[model samples]
Target: MKSALKKKNLVVLKVKDVKRDKELYLHQREAMMALDQSIIDKENNRFAGLIVLPTGGGKTETAVRWVLKNFINQHKKVIWIAHRRELIEQAFESVEKNAITALIDKRKHFNCRIISGEHGSASTIERNDDFIIASKDSLYRGLHHLEEKWLKYHKEVFLIIDEAHRATAKTYRKIMESIDKNAKKFQVIGLTATPFRTAQYEKGLLKKVFKNDIVYQVSLRTLISRGILAQPILKTLQTYINVAEDVSEEEAQLIEKNDTIPPDIANFISKNKVRNNRIVQEYIDNKDEYGKTLIFAVSQTHAVVLNTLFHERGIRSEYVISNGTDLFGKGIISDSNKEKIKRFKENALDVLINVNILTEGTDIPDTQTVFLTRPTTSEILMTQMVGRALRGEQAGGTKNAYIVSFVDDWQNKIAWITPEKLYVGQGVWQDCENNPASFRRLLPLKQIEQFAKIADDTIDTTELEKIEFIKTVPLGFYSFSLEKTNEDGSTFNKSCEVLVYENNKTSFEKLMDKLTAYYSIPDAKGAKKLAKIFADAEDLSVISFLASFGFYSSNDSPTINLIDDVKDIVSHFEINRTAPPYIEFKEREQIDIRGIAQKVYDMELGGKKKKAYIDDVWERNSFLQAYFNHKKLYFRKAIDTELLKLEEPELYSA
Candidate 1:
């Protein structure tokens, strides 16, 4: 047995970490920079904020670098909090290993103590082991292991929460409140991909936890198209009418606590031998393509059943579920389950099924396919589930992941988990409605698969002369601006935004509705229900991003001319009364052929505000890009020409 001092704490740190910090991907670097800048903006004052990186976006590494910058060697106490054992373990191991080896700090003393339960380390707080890893459950059980005076030893404290969406849990709140009411905590940093922002989640919890500070977000679509994550191809496998209708009212209302599924839904989903067998056959149908598969089921019994079905079909399979024999009832993840995951990672098992075991804080990128035997409507659950396969080739992934799901709207009314939730026309989130696109009603399953193939870049559909839109979706109206000048030659700008509750059809669109503040200027005050005003008018690039990557969590370009369509919408909704205009504040139409031309030219040298004009042109021209092309070639040229007139006034007069 290895000595306690020398024993590896599941993760071993070496010179590799020093190398790891230097080898950040561009996106990871951007995340680090964003965090760093946010901190700098705080002027070393007390600050709390979040870093939004999609899973597999190197959140760990970016966090490592950020912590090293602020938390290391300052004689400061640091606490990293996580709820799950996997996350707690992963955090301790990664931070410890990376700190010892990669940081390469002058101070050789560094230590990490894992505090979870009655029998945690009782060793004295040495200089080397100031960082503490506390499971929230451990804190709730007892505070005996930690002394009140000890909290004051460090001049400052840094609290970093992993899987931070859950940081507002009751236990977490108690711990944070205790700390906040006490000593000086320098900052709070939350790292998460799926931030719970719903009205239910937001209910004054997350804001209190993070102080509602600046938020930096990077979407999964941005990372995937940039080759950072494995591309996902989600395909729907519709369930039969009988199977869909069989989920009883009780089953529909089933809930899970600590991943223990309610008995009603567990039995309902697992006992359906027909659905079980169908899902198994679906797995086998593409077994050749899916080298390693993850089967997520509704409950433990359900997972066990799926495991048996896979084995019955001669596929190597294993399963680990919650409610293990441990006191916390989470032991399945301790030995038996961990072994299965280890074997799966080693390629010894072809398939692994579980009841929400690998949803978050577990990284297994080799999962080439995800079988969604369990459905969910929660974006948090689905996002974490799909993220299992989104890790890119750099992290032992195949660069391609498939989500195989079944859609029966009646069976699972929670819109969060259905296959149809992904049907965004042109595949953009901003354009998404709560309903499935009308175009989907026209295509068969196989044709839908073809569309997914196009999404994955596995095939090209440009050769198809015409897209057969057999059905038409009713269009929502939005106002537009044509940049028209009045008869007196003064520029007039007109816009109005209105709020409507599509609660009947779009209650889930709540999150994006927060865009109200951005577009609602005080001057445009009215009943505030104007259909003409839009919050996302200036930031419409998100439309393109959605078209390319679908919803960031779940899953287009249009046929009509974009500008023409906008004009039509604007014309329809716009109240066409030109505002009175009085100009003559500005100078001449042409550049003066006199002095100051050199001054303007000199301003374009570099780092000038006006230099952005030419730079903006170059930036837009770079958009021969396929993902969310926000190219504005003519706009850039116009800005450049105007800037040039300022630079060469003499030539302008000529």
Candidate 2:
């Protein structure tokens, strides 16, 4: 009768039991696997590297998968560091969801303990734990708690950094140094859209800490071509005249001193009668072309002025600035910022305006247009700001994005966002470094002859092709004109065709090429292959397969041996999309260590808990390999006086 009852109670299980996302796109999988391989090949926990997945290209998911396969399933521990709460929350969510799905895939169970500033209480991450995702600040604050020797319980502790380009920050340095002194061996991996900030402090720090590790990298172009990102359409809205030229030399100095446009230009771009009128009218006119937009403003006041102008023009928009100043110019609560972000994401708002906050790790895939009212010189800032709109929409149809940028004609620059180099039309791009012929520079801009041609009414087709704007010439006016030399050897315009020196290129080409250059490919062939991959597949990091060959530098051209290494890695990617060597993060079921610890605590205190006891429980748990090295005294003093918090919630307050 019991047997019959058991048989009758059998629950039919479907093949796809857990909610698994579509198979990771090719590049995503490759990046995860490559980073996993690099970590595993580590002889003794000195593995530090970076993966350059374009923003919104699911770097979080890729990193999460690596942690699950490499650390979680293997019973190892992971520390994921990111800057923003949103980034941390998203990262933790990805890890929790995907890691659990992975465990479910193997019919295994492991309590994935994730502690972060967002929600993870100060619960002790016991010996047999899974992952810990923390904001950079929280990680810094909790470095002492993180220093507990948990590695003896697993193979290695892993530090996965988001926005890895900021690796040189003091917080990360402290955490790394803490781990270093604790004798807790760890593998450090960084995720970033860009690697180097400058050739000095940032470059050195990244190279030294990551061991010059470019473990997995997909060219940005490949990401777009693979449909991993949207292709951006760019238009340069020139101001017609340089604002500095319009003002006196003293006024130019004053503008520079104030770090803002002179009152005249500010009023023009801001609340002035003529320019503001033109801006609103043009924006309304182009409403059909550009979809939901994000305007990056120069200042708080500037953002407000623009917001008012937008509202007056009936654009159905909202602005969310970081500061608490109300729209009416009086103080307002800032708590609604998150609500505003939520509404914006839900498409309840047609346009979002902000000052300086929507740059790093902010992903709004549905954003169709990004307007630059503020320009910056830092390539990192510009890249981040521009990349915000490059994320493909969730529904995913046409992948065209647009960037409408304004140039400050008077200063011969843009206000807040300035691209160092760009592939402009008519077969030309300015020298990004501002040194036209500086041969000492490491990254020279690669040239593409016959990139584009300007049409002429007077000149012949062949002559039109020859007529091109001079590189690095300040914006406004200049052109190559067909001229005939007089007998006196002086040349005059015979068939002059004017070319506006507007630094505008089809967005896809320059963005793809610039990101491709980040890969440090061996030769132009690799770049071309990467470009084709970007053009054809959403999985552009097929070139990342070559990263395993130790091609971390563009100067290091691939040799015969390296080419073979590339082929070998390619074969691996083609077959084993999971972990390499037949062991895909094994299916071993884990003991309910957290459950056991929690239960013990419930028994020890009845209804109360101590942070020290909770933290030291891992040190006492005999299930771990570290149990042998356990301190009997520490176990007895479960609620060690050294522990600061009195309850379980305090353990993960970081």
Candidate 3:
């Protein structure tokens, strides 16, 4: 007995050492460290926390590695729970693969069962079954089976919930409660990309479920910058499908409040032949640019129409829906959805259209583009749809992914979740025309919308110009202009833009208020108060505030320079002294308006056409019109060529 026990201990140590030596990405390493710490510092032998990682950031692999080392190798049981079928299958596959590498001891036998409505049963959960991958519904229904076979016997058990943003649902809560009551020692960890809840009640429930404990969190920007996830380039294709007249008041209210349109409206959009044709045409036009694509359709009919259209155009495409029937009640395509997905993963199929099936937990890392043909106001659904193509080069995917959204004219009724929301607070922008090679950055959708409005001749510019641009600052952005004297005694203007993410806006406002108050009462006591305020402010808020004054540094201990005018008020306040330990500062050049204008004017349009276009945009772009109207002389040279054409059109006639 002693010899056998010693051998078991040696196996466990061997597994731990092997798993430790395995290479983990920087974020994954940090997550593992946090999980280990959570386990060690758990109260009552129980720990519940959420792991927030963006899609394709390998949250599953990280959890599997940690569980294999800590639970499976130590002869403890683990129950991996997910609501979706794909999540359950994906979890099972990940654990199965990792277990092979970590659990090499033949003497130690372990078994895994997949319990879901379609697959294994909870009643068959054996005493020796070490790992269980189950759907929440299946596990909830079979709580008695789990309690009788394993929960009552095992003193320590680990519960991992995937797509855990839905943990507040009744089914999930019931399952967790049942397990808590049955098991003596319980630890629960939830994994999700979006931790935030839109509804107030749902937020409260989520907080209660996880004790407001987020063990480890990594942002989408962090993953992209670290090459763990791809940069998402948002492209909007206008479908020209106007359904405003078809919508009822009740439908509009439902869309605005619930983030869902009426079924009849969805069906109407799905059957629009013109809109369907445009979707297929986009794919055909950009076949080479958009390599392996996944399309989210509005309905089964929409998916079938798109798939048939692609096939008619001699493109390799397939569509999958929940049911095995076409819109006409005919049988589905010869190949099953799973088989089609397999072919898509193998690169045999260029495009795979689905109706709400591939949104969550379906791992298609090689998808280079995603066609969001269906409009949604739900941020969670939008995130999941876009995340399908977010796998990075380091993770065996491309460096850049394209999120092509089919935008329709909704008469500004529904506040749809555009692809720009992903980078609203991320402080990343890519001007494709200016810097095509730089995939790490992203241009905000608001800017794109502004430009589109300027170019749209149908929209009356007179009404648009009346609206104040100041009232509509892009989300998470603050912009101001500063003029500095050059060595030659001339002044050059620089536009300063700072990004205060949505989550940090409240703190940023508070910091600004405190600074404003301190400016009114400039004294050593006020300086101390300001210093305390800065200390309490979030790091991002402090960075944004400093950035407002042209101090753009990302260093841990950056030396901040105050403007000459505000020096007296903040003379006693040590800006550098209040920076957080992890604050990074990097110098960035300010935007040169003249240079940008020159580049815009350098486009291929002829003199007369360019002049007309510039004049049209000038009248339409409210912000530019306002600024240029006030400082017409200052920026006259920037648009001199266009103005010259207007004065002497005969000299430069098309």
The numbered model that scores best in TM-score is 3
| lDDT of prediction 1 | 0.52
The whole-model C-alpha lDDT of candidate 2 against the native structure comes to 0.50
Q: State the TM-score for model 3.
A: 0.50
What are the TM-scores, per candidate, against the unseen true structure?
0.49, 0.44, 0.50
Pairwise lDDT winner, candidates 1 and 2: 1
Candidate No. with top lDDT: 3
Q: Candidate 1's residue-wise lDDT over 443-529, tens digit each?
A: 223322333333444454432212211111112223222323346432222221111112211321322243232122322343143
Model 3, runs deviating above 4 Å: 1-30, 37-52, 64-222, 248-263, 311-314, 324-334, 342-348, 360-364, 377-380, 426-615, 618-654
Residue 258, candidate 2: C-alpha displacement in angstroms: 16
After aligning candidate 3 to the native by TM-score, how far in Å is the CA of 287 from where it should be? 2.9
lDDT of each: 0.52, 0.50, 0.62
